[model samples]
Target: MTEPDDAVPLRRRTAHALDLMAFSLADVRDGLGPFLSIYLLVTHHWDQASIGFVMALGGIAGVIVQTPVGALVDKTTAKRALVIAGAVGVAVAALAMPLLPGFYTIAFLQAVTGIAGSIFSPALAAITLGIVGPRLFSRRVGRNESFRHAGTAWAAVVAGGLAYYFGPVVVFWLLAVMAALSVVATLRVPGDAIDDDVARGMDKATSGQHRGPSGFGVLLHNRRLMIFAVVVFAFHLANAAMLPLVGQKLALHNKEVGTALMSACIVAAQVVMVPVAYLVGAKTDSWGRKPIFLVGFAVLTVRAFLYPLSDNSYWLVGVQLLDGVGAGIFGALFPLVVQDVTHGTGRFNVSLGAITSAWGVGASLSNFVAGGIVVAAGYSVAFMSLGAIAALGFALYLIAMPETATGTDSGPGVFALPHRRQVQRDAVVGGELVEDLDGKV
Candidate 1:
C-alpha cells in the first residue's frame, strides 16, 4: 500500500469538501435537466417529436467544443479559474433562457449549456486525479455520480413543481441561483488541494506541453480505447432510448406514471453504487476491468429485452435491479479504461474529457435516433433496439479490448510511448514515479 507521504491529508480533506460542492451543483443541474423536455413542450409549445430532436441536436452542437477543449484544459494554468467562470456561465445562460426570444433561441442555448458541461467533467476528473490519485478515484466517481443521478431523480419534482407553481420561468431562475452558488463555493476551496506539487511533478514527467491530434484523431490511434468509448456510447444510447420512451409507455397506464417509475428505477440503481465503489476500490486494478464490464453489458442486455414484457410497476423495479448491476460495473470500469490509456501521458484530464465527450455524443445519437424511431414505429421497438445495442457492446468488448488496469498489464511496459510513437524516457515521473506510480508499473 502506498503511504500518505506529504500530500494525502491535504488532498483527503479537500476531496471531501469538493465532493460536497460537486453534489450541490450536480443536484441542481440534474433537477433542471429532467424537466427540460417537458418545459419546452408545455411552456414553449414544442411538439414531442420536435422537442426530442431539438434536445439531441443541441447536445451534439454544443459538445462540438469538446473535441478540442481537452487540449486547452491540459495546457492551461487557469484550470480552476476557467472552471469557476464556466460554472457561473451555466447559471447565466440558464437564467437568461426566460429572456430568450423564441424556440430556436432556446435550442441554441441548449447547445451552449452542453459546452459548459463538457468543460466541467474532464476538468473535474483531472482535479480528482491530482488530489486523490487513482487510489480512491472510484469512490469519488461513485459519490459524485450518485449525487448527480439522485439530483436528476428529485430535480423532476422540484422543476415540475416550480414550473407549475410559479411558471417555467421560475424553474430557470431557481436553477441559475444554484449554479451561481456552486461558483462561489468552488472559489472558496483551495485549487491546490488537488493540484499541489504533484501536478507540478506531473507536468515534468509527461506531455504537459499539450501536443496531440484533435480529440477525435486521438480516438483513432488507440483500438482498445476506441472500443471502450463505443461501449460507453452504446450504454448511453440504450439509456437515451429507454428513459424517455419507457416513461411514456408506462404513463399510458396513468399520467406521469413513467416519470415516477423511471425515477424510482434510477434512484434504486444509484443507491447501490457507492457501496459497490468502495467494495470494488481495493481490487479494481488487480481483478481487472474488462471481465466486469463485459458481464455488465450481458446482464444489461437481458434486462433491456425483458423490461417491456413486464407491465406491473413493481415488476419493473426488478428490471432496474438488473440495470443497477450493470451500472455498478459501468460506473467503476469506464473511467479505469480512460485512465489506463492516458495514465502515464500527463494527459489524464484531457483523456477523460475526450472519453466523456464521446459518451455525450453517444447520448445525443441515441436520443435522436430513438426519437425518430419512436415517432415512426413505437416504444416496443425502442426497448428492443436498446437490447440489440447492448448485445453489440458485449460482443465488441469480448473481441477488441484487453485489461489495461495498472497491475494487470503484462508488457513490463518496456516499449511504451507516452503519445503516438514510442520515445526515450527515464522514470515515469521524470526521474522516479511517486511510490504509488512505482507500485503500478
Candidate 2:
C-alpha cells in the first residue's frame, strides 16, 4: 500500500488531483464531442442523419462497456493507471481520427475511443473518494467541476480560435497536446495518498451494511436508482443536441463566424459553471441535493424553451448562459446523489456506470432524434420539443426524487456563519485531513 508522504500537505494533494481532473476534462472529455459534429458536417459534407449515425457509434460502444468499466475500477488497485491509459487512448484515437478514410472506418475508430474514455469517469471518481473520503467529497467535487468547466471554457477559446484560422482539423491536434498535459497531471498525484478502503466506499462510517459482489441484478432492486436513471436519460435526451444543432444553424447562416459563435456558446455556459459549481459544492451538503438539482432541471427547461425564440447570435449566447446554471448543479450533485444512494453497497462505481449507460444512450440518440426533427420540421419545433421533454423530467424529479441530504452531524449546519472562539479540529489520517459530517477543519 502506498503511504502518503508525511511532508506533503493534504491541501496540495487535493490540488494535484484537481489539476489531473481538470486537465482530463480539457484533454478529451467534452472537447471532442460537440466539435466532432461540426467537423463531420463541415469537412465531410455529411448530412444530419449521417452525422448522427456516426456519433451514435461511440454511444453504442459506451453502453456496452459502461458496467464492465465500473466493475473493473472497483476491483482493480491500478485506478491511476486506468485514468492515464484512458487519457492516452482518447488522445491517440482523436489524433488518428481525422486521417481515417470512409464513414465506417471513422465510426469504428470513434467507437474504440468511446470505450477507452468510458474508464475515465469511474476511475477518477473512485480515486477522489479514496483520497478525500466522503466527508470532503462534496466540496472537492465542486472544485473538480469548477476546474472541469474552466478547462472546457479554455478549450472553447483555444479550439475556436485555432479552428477559425487553421481549420476544424486543428482541434484533433489540440486535443493531443492537452492529453499529454493530463497524463503529466495524473502522474503528479501521489499513489500512496489513495485509501483503497475509502475509495471503494467501504469506510468505517459506511461499513455497517454487509455487501457482496452483487451483479447487475442489484440495479433491478433499487427502484430509486432505476427511476433516477430514467430521469437522467430524459434529461440528456433533451440536453445533448441543442448546442451542436445551434452551431450547425449558425454555420448555415454565417459560415465564417459559426465556429467562433459555437465556442462562444460553450464559453458562456462554462464560465458561468465555474462559480455555480463552486457554490453547489460548498452548499450542496447544507441545502440538500433535491432542491438544488430540481432548480437545475427547471433552468434547463426554461433554457430549452428560450432557444426557439431567437436565432440571433447574441440572443442565443444569452440563452446558453442558463446551461451554466443547470450543468453546474448537475455536475456537482450527480455524483453526490449517486454516493448517497449507494452509500455502503460496495458497488458504487458499477451502479454509477449503470446510470451513465442510460445517460449515454439518451445523449447518443439525442443527435439522431433532434437532427431528424430539424431536417423534417424546423429548429423552433425541435427546441420546443426538447423544452417540453425537460419540463417532464423536472416534474418527475420534483414529484418522485427524495431529498438525499443528511446535513452535518456534529457541527453547526455547514451553511452556518463563522463564530469567534469556535474550536476547529482537522480530521487528518495518514498525513491527510479526513473531515467528518461536521464541517471542521
Candidate 3:
C-alpha cells in the first residue's frame, strides 16, 4: 500500500509542487471575491440589486457545472492540463474585468470565472490522491489546506494594502500574478508522476484489469454519502451567512471601521485555520473522522449562538474566531470522507463534485434566508435561527454519520457508534456489485 517511487527525488518534487499549486491557486480559485461587489458599486455606480444579480449569475453558473466538471476530472487523464487551463481561464476572465465593466460583459466574465474556478477542487484532490494514494491522503490534504489558508491570509494582506493605495482595480492584477504562479506550479507536477487510475479512486494493484467507473446511479444509492451530503448542506446553510451578517452589523454600528472590522474577521479566521487544518490532517488517521467532524459542527453551533450574545466589536470578532475551527476541520476532512465512502468505485471526484454542488446550494440560500430574517426580526433572531440549523446538523452527524477513517485498529472514539465497523462493503462498478476487498467501505 505504499506510494510508487516513495523514495525517489521525483516523488519529493511532485509533493512540493502540489503544495505550491494549492497555495497559488488559493487566490486564483475565488477570483476577485468581495472586490467584485466593491468595484461594480463604487466604480461603475451599479445599484445593489444589479450587483447581487450579477454575482448570483456567476454562482449559479458554478453550481450548475460542478457535477459535470467533476465527471470530466474523473474521466480525463490530462489532469495537469486541466488544472493549467482552469487557472488560465480564471486569470483571463479576471484580467478582462477592468476593460469591460458593462453590465452584460461583467456578467458574462463572472460566469466564465465561476465555471473555470469550479475545476480546481476536484482536480487538485485527484492529483493528490494520484500522487500519494489513500494511505497518505489525509496528511497530504492537511498540508494542502494549511498552505491554502496561509496563501489566503497572505493574499488578503497584499490585496488590502494594494487596494488601499491604488483602488479596487488593483485586485485584478494581483489575481493574474497568482494565476501565473499557479500555472507554473501545475507544470512542475510531472505528468508521469500521477497514476491516472489511482487519481480516480481505483485500486492501483487491480487498476490494470479494472473496468470503467460505476454508473452515476451508484452515488444516489449510497446511504452514508447521502447522509453526509445532507449534513454538509445544513452546515453550509448555517455557516455561510454568519460572517456577512456580522459585517452588516458592524457597518451599521460603526460606519468608519466597518470594512476594517470585516477584514479583521476574515484574517483572524484564516490564521486560525492554518494550525487547525494541520492538526486535523495530523490527527485524523489516529483520531478517526467522525469525532473530528462532530467537533466542527459543534463549534459552528456555539459560534452562531455566541454571535447573538454580544454586539461589541471585540466580542463579535472573538466569536468569529470559532469559524476557523469549524471551517478548518471541514475543509481538511471533506475529501478524506468522500474518498473513504467512494473508495474502489472509481467515482471519487464526481462524488466530491456532487456533494460540493449541494454545499453551493446551501450557501446560496443562506444569505437570502438570513437577510429576510434580519429584516423581519433582528440580527439576534437571525443569528439564533442559524444556530438552530447548526445544532440540527450536529445532531445528524452525532447520531448517524459513521467513522470514515480506515485501518484504525483502535476502538471507536466516544462519539463513534459501536457498529461503525459495518460500513457498506459492496460498491457498484459499471453495473456490478464489486466487493470491497480492502474493506475501505
TM-score of every model versus the real structure: 0.79, 0.91, 0.84
Clashes of each: 1, 2, 0
Worst 10 residues of 2 by lDDT: 413-422
> In model 1, which regions exceed 4 Å deviation?
1-12, 27-31, 41-45, 98-101, 150-174, 196-214, 250-253, 256-266, 310-318, 408-441
Model 2 alpha-carbon drift over 4 Å, by segment: 1-11, 205-209, 213-215, 408-437
- CA lDDT, every model vs. true structure: 0.60, 0.76, 0.77
Report the C-alpha lDDT of model 2 over 112-155, residue by residue, as the tens digit: 77887788777778777766666777877787888888888888
lDDT winner between candidates 1 and 2: 2
Question: Candidate 1 lDDT, tens digit per residue, 98-193?
Answer: 788377877777777777766666666555555444544554565555554444444545554554556556667767766776676567546544
Ordered from best to worst TM-score, the candidate numbers read: 2, 3, 1
Clashing pairs in 3: none
Residue pairs clashing in model 2 are 2-192, 427-434
- State the displacement of the C-alpha of residue 302, model 1, in Å, after optimal TM-score superposition: 2.4
Q: Per-residue lDDT tens digits of candidate 3, residues 32-95?
A: 7556655665567665456556765666677788888888898998998988998999999989
lDDT of 2 at 41: 80
Best by lDDT: 3
